[model samples]
Target: MAFRYLVGRGKDRILVDTGNGNAEYIQAFQSILSTRDLTLSKILVTHLHPAHAGGLDPLSRVTWVSSPTIMKHGHSPRGFPNLTSIKYTSLTDGIIIQTSDGDTTLKVLHTPGHTRDSIVFRLSEEDAIITGDTLVPHDGAASVVLEDPVAYLASLRRLDALFPKLAYPGHGDVVVPATDLIKRSIEEQMQLPERIIEALCSGGGIMDARDMVRRLIADAPEEARRNFTGTVLQHLLELEKRGKVRKRSVPKRVPSAAYEERDPDRIKGPGGLTLAQVSKLVKESRAKDDKVYGLKPVEKSQEKGKDFSGAESGKSGKLERSEVVQLHPAHRELEPLVEVVWSVV
Candidate 1:
């Protein structure tokens, strides 16, 4: 989770990234709001990822503000009300916030690698920067999977020159000696494209995003693979955006489509399957209706690859990295399965 700051004066309060829509997140946010007795004046969403912007659904009464570039997506989670999007708000560098108690300005540094609208807020008074997934204090590698390496590299360099002391990120502890932290983060992120290009240039042989993720971090634990894969997709998408890679070559899935296909309602799973695909899997699992009765894979005798079932029986469904065969759900179960996937996506 990225750390969000509440910077305002007197009675007004600004809520940063609402976190997710889970019980823990909702309770925490409610507690915080109750303690401060603050009604959300402005909700600043750094980007539209679920972990950062998922909580906006509950705070529908507030004015939601986001980069003009991101505003086109409309309010997140789809059905929220009182949504107001502001664009063409030339927030290239520092932006000033006018309040009754003078000015509480924030330096809006648009760092594009993590996401197109990803920004880092710098508070001069505290000498602290709010790095939204761009720089983590520990074990925090820039989310390269779906990021633009070129823009990301530039963003890192800019951060290095701007602040030299400390950084408070979306998650984890604060980073001291900010210059060093920025340098290392940039260096590490810069290598991602090169590595991918190398693997592609070598014998990796036109691997998809998922394959590249597995190859990039072979030694990482299975539990962490999904996250690492997501980060890798961020990089790949950015590369595609830069013309360094081709989008047509990438696999067509539903989850990535929420952003890639420009359809925010759909969610893509980390397994390279789209939300629609996952829903299909779950529907075929129950084998209830005649539609689901014949939901088996097209080829049963083919030993070339594993078949995908709508659902995995027992605890195997919970396994993060497994290649075992499972059952798909019945047609009736499709909607619920999709809902579950969307809740996470």
Candidate 2:
């Protein structure tokens, strides 16, 4: 939270990001409000994740404010703390919060990265920014949380350009010199493409998302594994945009468990991808209420150097990097270190 005082308008105080819906968590928040003699006038959540918006069911008597993403997906995939109560006021970029005697204002900026609805509150008067999961102190808040590393990179750069003197992240230990921290985070993010190339070069064979994690983020904290996964994926997407990476063409089913065409949602191809022809068959199979199935691909037959899934990488599901392209000039020295080519699915 940027400022406890900025939570509400006038004299009444508001809550930001309801903790969890559990009894212990609810009590902790109540304890704070009671001790402070603060009337809960409103609540503002960054994203509707269980951890951030879970306490809504028990503590959401007051009005709430959040991005439109909240209004669209009321609850997360976990389905805890049904967000059926209290319609939230949708927030957009450049909106101002009238918090005080007409002198104080809190500006909201849509910073989508950690999650689509992730946002930050910029308290210009205080020279501080309340960054939700969008800008955490450690691991950049990546988890099961779906992140668009491309959008994430742009959001981080935006935050860096607006780098304030103080930053309060959604998680992780608090630190000082927030500007420096944001810079370090951006630099780390920018270097991922090269790191990915290095990881692929070292493997020298077909790799999958799991393999990428094992090789690239080997020393990462256990909790941050998902975050690193999203991070690598983000860079991979960017590299694909630059024509440096490509997804492995999915293969035709061979009647195996992993590749059984009859299996629900099973798509097999190069790097374990589902090419267009394969995807069409899957769709057509499900559409047919009848048990009749389409003709299966000849055992081990391929599309003959094709993307089978016809997906633009990251859209049709997990993508594999079949080859690596040089990322930058300064890193050219490492190119020679890559003796063999590789692929990832």
Candidate 3:
């Protein structure tokens, strides 16, 4: 979910972060503008993500304002593809747009981390700030998608320095006593690294992201799985940066150059044991009373057979027709050495 705000009175409406591109939202926006008799003069996007800027093309006639960094990086057009003739204005830190007479202005604050192009707009007149996904209110706590956790923490500190009276987040109720909420968010973020380390320790020092998620945040709602995984990855990256953790690649069997040369035709087609051979191996293992896991006998219907015919020079220098077994999709290049292998649980 996304929240877009309409600020200012009739004829001077300023829109902040267009909602996700959907017909229902577009109709709702039109209805609001018609009911209030307001004309949208400008659109401000906090970041370049689809949820925040997907509807930009629909409102292309108005002046679109965003961070100069985002424009320089060419993220705007990619986010709003249909906006062929965009009227974009670059906003820098401390730049102010007057929202009302007598010194009322909205100030721009570059807060990168949720994304490299993230920014927050502070309406000093109302003692409020519009933070788009930089700080999200969730489960009586606040969280952020940390594209750069270090930068994210710094940005949070920057907001805390402002001591905003109210915080308008991208996907929740406005936070009152905004300083307290900011502090809570900072505290939660600070604990993430330790939490991740604890999860790793409990799993005997090495665990893939999915396993870590299941162990550390199994109680989290299903809808929150994506955010939890993102958070875990952020912490894992930070730990790796500090040399406390290392990422390893899973091993895969590859065909050796010598093997490929020796059996070029066999390598060309599917190269695996036949169903009969697999069944024989399985039966032998069961007779020995070995506990095998992740082993299943191939069904006849699932097997694909192919016939290849070719001519190759024989040892006597005579051309002769040769037939080779076609390779199956699962075992195209590598030779099938074993029917199944067991991993330690």
The candidate that wins on TM-score is 3
Candidate 3: how large is its RMSD? 11.9
Q: Write the per-residue lDDT of candidate 3 for residues 69-138, one digit (tens) a residue.
A: 1221123322233332455777667777654332446788888777677889998778999898887776
Q: Output the lDDT of residue 297, model 3.
A: 28
My TM-score estimates for the predictions, one after another, are 0.54, 0.62, 0.63
- In terms of lDDT, model 3 sits at 0.57
Summarize candidate 2's per-residue lDDT along 25-125 as a digit string, tens digits: 66766676557765554467776666777666666443323211222223232223345466667767878765434544568788876666777778777
Global lDDT of each candidate: 0.51, 0.54, 0.57
User: Which residue pairs overlap in candidate 3's backbone?
Assistant: 269-327, 270-326, 270-327, 270-328
Model 3: runs farther than 4 Å from truth? 9-11, 61-85, 100-103, 140-143, 221-223, 248-345
lDDT, model 1, position 117: 63
lDDT of 1 at 214: 44
- Candidate 1, residue 100: Cα displacement in angstroms equals 3.6
